[model samples]
Target: MSQSNLFIVMSIIAVISSQPVRGKDCVCELQNSESAFPESKLSRVEITALECIRNISSEKMTEVDRLVLGLQHRLQQLNENVSMLEKEDNGNLYGAVSLRIIQLELAEIQDLLDKLGTTNTNNQQLSTEMADQLRDMKYTIAELENFDHTMVVLKDQENQRIKRHLKLCEEELNATSPPPTPTMGNCGLGQMVNVSGAKTYSLTVYGTSYSFGAWGRDANPVPGDENKYWLVVLSSSNVFGHFVRQYNSLSTILLGIGPTDTHISSSNPTTNTIQGPNMVMYENALYYNCYNTLNVCKFNMTTRTVTNVALPNDAGFNNKFPFAHLASAYSHTDMDFAADESGVYVIYATTSNFGNVVISKVETSTPPVLSQTWSTTLHKKTVTNTFMVCGVLYATRYLDKDTEEIFYSFDTKTNTERYDWRIHIKKLQTNIKFLNYDPRDHLLYVYSDAYILTYEIMFR
Candidate 1:
């Protein structure tokens, strides 16, 4: 070992020893060539980086929340729209418009769902809820689309039915003789000039809760049941009825005595039940609008059997052309069974006739065929009620709570119509749900707001 080398080695050892020993816990201070690095500057940079990351995360979350809230609001609106459509679905006539509206809303909802899915990709729970709501809305939209298709199919079927009926009507008219004209012998009462005030007024035996109903004596009664009176009180929201109450006489009904007989039309609304407030008792049978269909039903009191005949397919039903006024509309009152001196007639409105009044002569034979049909220029919705007297179809309109004016008339025998007749009929209530003429008694039986009223028809 040389002396200079040994001295160099000792100097290196001392320099290394003077640098200071460091433990695991000791922190080293770094420096640039000129000075030590600033601790405050490093701390500030770290804090700024953390704040930036936090701000970015918060902004993303806010966007996601906004999307979720918008989606929820849209879903709520869609649900309300569906509910409204269900409520206004009347015989599928207005379904097309409703379906279109629903489809548009569904499209908007789908767009919102897409936005939500894109904006909130990280939240699994929120994403799941949104997906579920979207799926439900899709299902609802599918149902509405199906309903639209069904309406189309049903319309097609109805068109076919109308063609068949038209052909049948032509054949029948050609086969039958010319309809009889109104004469003194056939109809002793001349033209209806006026209607007297209520001769008989009484609430229903079932109480005022009935609200809608009909009451009249049989126009063509059986030999022994000449004085028999029939009542049909609508139940179930004033839309459906399943029974016909009978009384031995007008005296009994006016006295509110318990019914002598009760005839069951059906156990449920699905079967052969009365649908509208308009009904008539002719001979030993009760004629009315059949349940949920455009048919005239003949329910025999003796046999307890129901027979129905489909009206003209163009005939409106299920409130399509219901009897309406400025204040309210009578639901399910499309088919009005009216008995006259001539025979049983059904008065209704038809779409083909531009919602005008249509009168059809219904033969009380097996299955009750429609023998003759007449279309009038009178709009059926404008009239509150109608009745047949001596082969004349008379329409009435509301004047006030206590009066109804006979403003229109259509003579089936002459095929003539008059619209300026202002024969006013006094009433006990504002709404007359049912008004029918009994040829046997020569009286007008009006069921008005759960009240049974009878009026005498004066002729000229």
Candidate 2:
């Protein structure tokens, strides 16, 4: 590539670095079968697969992810639909539509009669066809993976070429472009000569403490909600704080939308009508806890109607054994719930006679019914706490010269039933009056008395 072309690529890299919160495609190189993830057992080909992933563009990698999600959802729907045909033989209206597609219904009554002594529809035919369709789906999935790898390689080449050109152009502009001209509502943008920048738009969702500057008492809403995905703002009073909940129709959250305490009046529905409003947009339906009851539910944003999922009995909606008064008995510091890449977990204080601390987790995967509860007193500081990005948990507690608590990492993997312990404790920044986990990046952020302490986590 020309010297100018190389500079262009470097400028693009600078832009990528500017959005540091996005860790996707952060690895510059690929991993493969030979060099697969730090797994105990790996095929030789895994290194190449890792290499392919490392070499690709972040954009393409996300695209493939979206496609796979779409595919999985479609497959799930198909399976659910197919399962509905179960009661067809009885010919009841409950499954009337489904019955027509039932195994025996697929053939003529006369053909069924002539079949054999035991007309147990071999379905060997359908099985064969099912196998074929499965193969096709597998093929499509593989194609998507290959396409992701190919795109990554291509983008790297394009970026390397574009960087050289960008750098040269940037230098020339610095030397020749007229000094920046200031404009309204612009923050430091006019200072950058010719590199155009967009005006940052500020959308206030909630109020901050400075507004109420009303001293004596400040309350931060309890923010252990991984399912609802919330921002927990600590109050000036230190004892009281409430979480401001918002609707996240899209799984992805925007970055740098500074904390807002303004109340969001959702037009969708009332809280009393539904259980705990832990709203999560699942493809189409909005899944949540009904009035914070054991009955997990779903609401369609389009229809604004609650949906009843066919889950196990343990997912019952009532004053069940577990939730009858779990909150009341637990420390009053309202629990924060979070759903990682795996199932949902409750972050709360397991108030035993012993000193109260912060820690909670999910022991099972199925909905409505959880098999176990993992609780531990991770820190001695027991004032207030919340989970931030990059899987780090932060808390605020009394600080004695002899003892102080800061931040820690609990678990790393996405899905796990067994509590294979992986906890890291490192004494960190004090005076973090407030802390919030930004979904945009995996950074444990804290608002100390002064500037923001952005803790960059290094994952193994």
How do the predictions measure up, each by TM-score? 0.59, 0.28
TM-score computed on alpha carbons, candidate 1:
0.59
In terms of TM-score, the best-performing candidate is 1
Best by lDDT: 1
How would you encode candidate 2's per-residue C-alpha lDDT over 9-94 as one tens digit per residue? 67777887887765467434322323223232223235444554554445433333333433343344345446534423444543
**Each prediction's Cα lDDT score?**
0.77, 0.34
Candidate 1 lDDT over 273-375, as tens digits, reads 8898988888788888988898899999888888999987888999999999999899998988898877798889988999998889999986889989898
